[model samples]
Target: MGDIENIDNLLALEALLQVTFHNRSLLLRAITHHSCCSETALRDSYDTLEFLGDAIISAHVVEYIYRSFPNASEGDMTALKSEVVSRRVFALIGQQLGLFPFIRVDIANLRTFNERSRDSLCADVLEALVGAIHIDQGAEVARDFVARAILPMVEQVSVQADTNPKGRLQKIILQRTGSLPRYRVLEQSGRNNDRIFLVGVYDQETLLGLGKASSIKEAGRLAAREALETLQKQRGKASIIDVGDESQPQL
Candidate 1:
């Protein structure tokens, strides 16, 4: 980690993100990880910015979906929103922006950093960047950045909506049990910046399946998928009526 006064890095980042920062310090702060904050003498970390950014992204997404899909049901709108605001989606966009090279982290922390940590870091930095943009410019500019840089990913999600396990599971459970599926964060571990989430999906009072992943949303989706598969298997079994002739049904 170095000083935030590096003009070259600032210029490079501006070029990379296709957004100019009026305040370069916000840009630097956006890319900084919490692990490097104390060592770099930065009084502010990206956490606060990330929080703001998360809300900003969510609001924009909700508005976008609501306007774009006026006839869509609440469940459909929710499904689409989930795809857009997901941590996995954010991390993928971050990777496309080449954010990893620009992220500042302490060397000691680097040793323990795995794919999970990388995904979380990229996701956080992207959100923080959004926060930074909103602060330095305005909501319109931030919205433009999101629309230009990140919104295109929505196409992929739209195409792959059929493969969304959570949505599929929701439909199947609603049809079969006439009840909504429930998800709970069963456990969380690791540092705040790179926590592992364990989520469980329940059908009413019974625990149907469990899943673990880098983010709670992903973990919940996985759990729903597992539960869906389990329910499908249970449904696959032949009933007594199906196993024998209906004409000889008397016991």
Candidate 2:
């Protein structure tokens, strides 16, 4: 929101993104959170640009998956896309870009920010940066940015998605219940950086599993894995019970 005063911030950000901006103001706005905006009426924050960038990034990711995975089924491509294009993944990638120090937020909020809030902020800012690039340099440059920053993650995500417990659980639940399994945060503790997430997966009213990890997404994955294992055991027990039923009449 500052006028021509955040030049140093702009230069550092440009170096980080490796894309110089002609409209430095746009870049500045991209790093500026809504809390820093002094006026509600003025266009001063990354919120709108983040929205646009969400669509732009999704489009680019979808196109890339469609072309690169031509032999894959629709379900496969979708599963791959879901892993790589998620907010948690984006936040992880954004951290590697070293964008945190350049972001402008209210001092109070910044001080109190937890890992979840930090991840959300990083993801939103990355999207806003793409939106700013699309506006200042056009769609191709924006695509290039994503190619450099985001697409490299697809291979890693693909490997994980191949055996992704979360995805597997979703498929099973969707097939059996005609609805996806739900996850709930059970507990949290520790400081901002060291925070832990305890999550539980549920099938309607039944609790299938619980897991604890440093991130919500990872915790959810663990919970799903547990649920799958539990289901397998239950099936095994059912099979044993059926075999032990000697009350059945012989044929």
lDDT of 2 by residue, 129-184 (tens): 99999999998899999999998788777755534688888889888899889999
lDDT digits (tens) for residues 1-251 of candidate 1: 34554677888999988899998888988988877777554455788889889999888878877887789888888878887888878988888888988887775856576787787799999999999999999999999988887777766776665337877887887987999999999999988767899999988889998999878977988898788778767766645446666667588
Q: How close is candidate 1 to the true structure, as a TM-score?
A: 0.69
Which 10-residue window in model 2 sums to the lowest lDDT? 155-164
Span of ten consecutive residues with least summed lDDT in model 1: 238-247
Which residue segments of model 2 deviate by more than 4 Å? 1-5, 109-112, 162-164, 170-197, 200-210, 213-218, 225-251
User: What lDDT score belongs to each candidate, Candidate 1 first?
Assistant: 0.82, 0.86
Pairs of residues clashing in candidate 1: none
